[model samples]
Target chain A: MCTGSEANDLALRVAKQATGHRGVIVTENAYHGVTTEIAAISPSLGGVGSLAEWVRTVRPPSGDGTAMVADARTAIAELQAAGHGVAALIVDTAFASDGFIAPSAETRAALAAVQALVRAAGGLVIADEVQPGFGRLGARGAGSGAAEASLWGFPRHALEPDLVTIGKPMANGLPVAGLVARRDLMQAFGERVRYFNTFAGTPVSVAAARATWDVLHDERLPEHAADVGDELRGMLAELAGRHDRLRGVRGSGLYLGVDVVDPESGDPDTPAAVALVSGLRERRILISASGRDNAALKLRPPLPFSRADAERFITELDGALGDLG
Target chain B: MCTGSEANDLALRVAKQATGHRGVIVTENAYHGVTTEIAAISPSLGGVGSLAEWVRTVRPPSGDGTAMVADARTAIAELQAAGHGVAALIVDTAFASDGFIAPSAETRAALAAVQALVRAAGGLVIADEVQPGFGRLGARGAGSGAAEASLWGFPRHALEPDLVTIGKPMANGLPVAGLVARRDLMQAFGERVRYFNTFAGTPVSVAAARATWDVLHDERLPEHAADVGDELRGMLAELAGRHDRLRGVRGSGLYLGVDVVDPESGDPDTPAAVALVSGLRERRILISASGRDNAALKLRPPLPFSRADAERFITELDGALGDLG
Candidate 1:
């Protein structure tokens, strides 16, 4: 695949073809890719109103397995009523646009419940690991179990997803992405459909991906990210104690999100988040805001971002917050 | 765009958005891209039966403008009756999959006639130059006018296409493609929708495209291709006189095709073409078969293929044909 969008677009097609259904279920504020079909399922792009008729949006998992399961049931019913039975339920592991939901037992259980419900309805589960996979969510030991397999290197996750899409950091910069799925599902689709892209799987692109993989293992970049991410979170938590505007900090590994809230009503302060993002840019500490309301400061840095770099970010963020006040 | 598929996919979206129509018209056996929506309009993929309800296909111009125009009228009527209306008519400038249709005054006139009819129905014209654009076709003098603009470099084609997609050889090897459209159409789509690809327009990708452009002009590659292509076609014609299997040669610049036919019936000999391709491979000369029946020998070499290379190709082809007999 040339981009993550292509991977996701292909994933949807594979799901529909393998399951013989056309309906799709995605999380609210979910962003899978930019292609026409992928974009139609990406509610984060233009909101739920922009979704195609065959698509249904469920709210992102919020620890309450009951609500998430109930929403999935409703969405599945809606799709079935429309004559487009559920084909797949796709979700970004990080839930980046849904305020970067943190990984936890409850979160995992909520996801599993939704996946189970979709599978029971004869729909596949697609974990979009484009953002949270590839060691961005920290490294887990071998056999850490299927729950831990959402991140790269922990392939033994207990949850058996029908398809998993990976991209963005695969080749570091070169265009490369792929879809990992059950052998039977792949064979079913591959036997009938002839999928070919001009530059996909080219020698140079594959070489880049191989080199990046080798570097990641040789340097133990995931471990490095884990350590630095811990320090960064600690610093942000300390800063939050000092500044009331800093509402909360959450996320895993290097992909952390800091919430900025209105001091008066404790509501999401989108303008304040925007101001802080601009301030960080002015101070030469690059960062951006994400989530549905753009209230969470998205801090996804390079795997090699060091403790010293974290210190600089913390220092600049502190100064920027003070200046804002 | 990262690849031609993405470019075409985006082009369709832009066309639909700008024109406020859902119908699409493409040539018979045309392949534009691989995305789901694109694959629907691409008749060469799964045949006309697999075409989406909104899509209609017309025969390629074969020197008969009247028949082509009538086909377009029927397709338009079908689309209109289906309530899809007409959004755009996309064509590969070289007609590569349609066995590399040679450019001619009749071909251009037929294309212009189809464009006029589609325009009258408020549909835009999209030129997919992924194969023949970017100087792959012979070069023309600066300001050579509309007749010369069918090839790359000259943009003054009498037909002002609403969008033109270019890719494949743009960066020589790197995956880089772009959609060049009229400003108003682009603006209309851009204002309502946001489009971004991860690796597209990166510094490295852009540099590669820029360097390729500089070399195309500085090395006069288009002119070189023209000279070599003419020599190669002449040699193939000379060889055809000796071998009854060799039928006809056609194309422009580096993009040329040779027809292989049965000696007695003068009908396409697909096996003979396949054997010839294999024979050339045995001789360490690389080429491929094209056309709906896979009977035409596709001889699209690098722009820098020289007269010496042409001689070598002719020698190898002559041997292959002899061995086949």
Candidate 2:
């Protein structure tokens, strides 16, 4: 069993301990976890605990996927030349909490590119899928959109990582997760010591996951998430364009980010983000900041959140934006 | 809530972050957890992991307790004077995973004294109650002793700490824990950033704790454990002087450890310890090596063990020890 935080920690540890890799790689504005290891790999995102010695941050990819992929290659060499061996490449599947932003086609390919590089460098790749799994990305109320596209557009299918870490809604808060690796790594872990959590494989949490998956599949929440996500993005776009403080919209499926901005320069708007998030809470819609300093509003409603809820959220956001004005 | 490993990790994090201490002070033979923090803090404990930076070890007390405590004091001063902050004074209580070997009273007193000095120097102290809490020490039957003792120990003694993390059997195998801090610290954490875990506070786990606690208090297991522990120790003592390999006993309440050695050279008889544990397991009593390379045989039965069971265990142990001949 792994907390999203622990999953990341063990991921780094596995890389460092197993392959003799000293250089750990992460991405800008990426969140690993609240613990020391996870935060260490993340740069200024939450790396305040003086763990930079163990991390190398690659700039997050923007429009061009190839450049993003190239960025990973550069990071590996730089780290290796600096005498720190690259052990593994760590990537979060979607920038869900950071900005609800999914990687571009080029960025996804870059992820694949680096996977091969890291493996040749005697490193592994760990994909963090905590938020996207369990059908949160395909809610129907969001309007059928790109999220429901074929395997090519499917976010998780974008990369075939060596290891995958998942948690959160896996058991609907029942507290269970698995650090599933390829047969080799799993055997290595199993051979050294059998891993078991007292509460990890609990019958109760297992039951919860089974029940939750049934509900998700039976109701086709993933498909629904796509519908709601497309519609929500359309509505959010109008809000972002109309308001001077609201920046561009990022994210796909139901995982969305309402980028707050500095009214004057349109730079990262930390204060605006806080105001809007707090404002949403006052209006009785739970939402909070995503990355460092509460710079982006994270909107991760349950998979079952309906269109009415989305409309109501946008309506309140419109009013909240006006109140700030 | 937290696991034994997490509890230990958080303890050190508080110590270092709170005290500005970089180096950790540990006993020569100690097992903290399976995480990086614990591994850094406890290097001598035998596990798959290796040593980490900023860790300093000292030999355990030699019955007088003076040697070890003095070692700690001297080590802390040296580390601090050399620009290392002695953030917190951390130690497993008298009996640690080192086969429940209880330090002498003097050693215990010295530890508390050094911790007080460290606290005076602006550090914290964390008591890892994961192994012994909730009636494990005094428990005789299926969680009755340990569980009851833990509940009453905290609420009754007013052993208020700056922080306390409890997990592992909190839900009888449910992944849940409580990171209890003084209101101020928790408030500070909340103020800086909101913290939430999907599975850390599972309702089913909560229910299990409630059920476990209910059975504990209702069954009067603590008294039974105390009653049984006394009997078990006496039997072990009678056998101790009789056997050339048996040296001494460690721990309190129901948690007991039999010293296995030539009773003369004072060197650890690791192979013998392993044999006895394996033999016990083969005989259908599940146990493991407690600390430091199978040096001490461990026996932690469910809380609801009975006097008849203890008698049976004694018979089996005598047979196993005789087989060592």
Assess chain B of each prediction and give its TM-score.
Answer: 0.94, 0.83
The most accurate candidate by DockQ is: 1
State the displacement of the C-alpha of residue B294, model 1, in Å, after optimal TM-score superposition.
1.7
RMSD of each: 2.3, 5.0
Candidate 2 CAPRI grade: acceptable
lDDT of each residue in A77-136, candidate 2, tens digit only? 888888887887777667554445465666666666777788888888887776666566
For candidate 1, write residues B45-132 as lDDT tens digits: 7888868889998888776556777899999999899889999999887777876666567766877888999999989999898888
Residue A152 of model 1 has an lDDT of 57
User: Fnat of candidate 1, please?
Assistant: 0.65
Q: Candidate 2: lDDT of B106?
A: 62
The candidate maximizing TM-score is: 1
lDDT of 2 by residue, B266-312 (tens): 77788888888878878988766656655766656666777788888
